[model samples]
Target: MSSHHLVAVDWGTSSLRGALLDADGRVREEQSHPRGILSVKPGGFTEVFETLFGDWMRPLGTRCLISGMAGSKQGWVEAPYCPCPAGLSEVRAKVLEIEPGRISIVPGLNDSHDGVPDVMRGEEVQIFGAMALTGLRDGLFVLPGTHNKWARVKNGMVTGFRTFMTGELYSLLSQHSILARTLDTSAPLDEAAFLQGVTQSDNGQGLLHNAFGARTLALFDRMPTRELASYLSGILIGEELRTQSVHAAVDVVLIGSPALTQRYQLALQAAGTQARTLGAEATWAGLHAIHSTSHRKT
Candidate 1:
C-alpha cells in the first residue's frame, strides 16, 4: 500500500529502534525499545521485534531492513563484516537475509589495517548518510557514542576507521571505580572543572595517574565533590583526542546526539581543531540509501 513501508531497524547492545519508511524512504513513523539485543533472553530477537511493531506492521508485510549489533554474533544472526575501502554497493551486496530474504541485516565494516584492527557496526550508516546530507564527498567523521568512532572516507568510499571507548570507560570509572564514592552522577557538569581536566591531560602524568586527581581534588578540598564527574569527563575526552591527534590537524565532522557532540566540540576546540555536528537523522538517510541501492539491483 505504501510502497514498501519496510521496517528499518538499528538494534544495538542497549537499545533498539525501528522506522517505517514510505515509498520515498521517508520515515512515516518510528518506534523505540530500551530492551536491546543483549537485554533480551536467548533467541528473543524476533519476539522483541514482534512486541515492538508486529501488530502495526503485520498487515503491511514484515519484510524489513536492519543494521547495527543486530548483525553481530550476539545479535539475531551474525552478518559477517565487509572489508574496508568499501563503497555503498559493496556494503549493500553483503546484506544478510534472516528469513530467506524476508528480513535482512546490514553487515558492519572491518579495517584489517595494522595496529588495533578496527570494526564498526552501525556507525557506517551514519557516516555515509552524513556525506549525503552535508555534501561532504570525502573527509573524516567523528561518531561519538559509548565507543566513539573515527572513520575516514575517500572518494565516497569508506576507507577505514578506528574506535575509542571513551563513553564506556567514563561510565565504568565514574560508577564502579574508586572515583564513584565522591562523584554525584546527577550533578550538572561543571565546565571549568571539565576544561581544567582537558588542560592538564598533557602533563605527562599518564591517564591512570590523572584519574587519581579526581579523588585528590575531593579529599584535599581542592574542588567541589560534585564537579569530579565533569572533570573526569574532560580527562577521558581529552585523552581520546590525544590518541587521535591526527584528526586534530584536520576539520572533523561529528555525528551524534547534541549533548555528546557539544562536549566533543569543546575538547576539539581546546585541541585547536575545527569541528561540526550532524544529528540522529543521518542514520535514517544512510539506511534509505542502502534500501534504494539494493532495490535498484533487484
Candidate 2:
C-alpha cells in the first residue's frame, strides 16, 4: 500500500497555491505559481497545470483537493457553483476529476436576486474551517481580497454571501486610471483621512459621492498619493462593511492575508462591531477534516 497523503490547492485568478499535508493534515510542503486561470491561454490549461504540478509532486503520493477559480469556465474544466445553503454533500457532488489523482474542486457559491449576483471561490473553505474551529454556527465572515466577500453562515452551513469588487476597483484606479499616477504605493495610511472616509462612507448612501474625494484630495494637494490610496481603500472597505455589518448580532470573522485582515479588523472596530482575524490557510485544515471524516483516499 502507498503512503499517500493530502494535497490541498487554493487556485485563483493570478496564482496557484498547493500544499502537501501529512496524515494529520499538517502542511508538509507548499508551492506556488502565477498560473491562475486568467494567466493560461485558451485550451492550454492541462499543459500549464502539468508544469506546475510536476514541480510540486516530489513525494509522489497525495490526494489532491482543489478550490477557487480553477473550476471556472476558463479553468482546466468547469465545476459549477453550488448555490448558497450549500453543505458537505453539495461540495462532494461538485468534485472534479484529474489525471491519475483523486481531485476535488470546491465550488463557488452563487446567489442572485433582483439582478444582483454575489459569488465566491476558495475563501469559503477557509470560512468553513474558521467556523468549525470557533464553533460559531452563525455570524458574518468577511474575506477581504480582490473581490471582498461577506458571507453569512448559519447552522454550520454557508447560508448566503455577497461579493464587493472593492479591491479590484482599487487595483484598476490605482494602476490604469489617472488616480494611479498620483497615488504612492509606499506611503503609510493617514489616520485622519481614513477616519474621515470610514465615518462618512460607512453607509452606502454617500459612497459613490465619497469616492471622488480621492481625486479631489489629490488635485488640491491636500493629501499625498500614498495617503490618498489608503483613504480610498478605507472608503471602499468602509462602504462594504457598513452595508454588511447591519444586524450582525453575532461577531464577524475577517479572513484573509494578515494585512487585509488587520485593515478590516480596524475598520470593524471603529464601527463598534466585534471582529477577529482568521488566516486563509484554515481552508486547508477544513479540507483535511472533511477528507478525514469522509475516509476519502488519495
Highest-TM-score candidate: 1
All models: lDDT? 0.84, 0.75
On a 0 to 1 TM-score scale, where does candidate 2 land against the true structure?
0.88
Model 2, residue 14: distance off in Å is: 1.2
Model 1 is weakest, by summed lDDT over 10 consecutive residues, at 54-63
lDDT of 1 by residue, 1-298 (tens): 5546667888999998888877676777888889788898888888887788775566545468788998998989999999988889999989988876567899999996565578899999888778878888678899989999998888889898888898999999989998999998788878888889988787888899998899999999998988888899998888877877555545578999987898888888877777878986888888888888888998
lDDT of 2 at 140: 83
TM accuracy, model 1: 0.93
Question: Which regions of candidate 2 are displaced past 4 Å?
Answer: 1-4, 41-43, 55-61, 202-205, 296-298
After TM-score superposition, what is the CA distance of residue 173 in candidate 1 from its true location, in Å?
Answer: 1.1
Model 1 residue 192 CA deviation in Å: 1.9
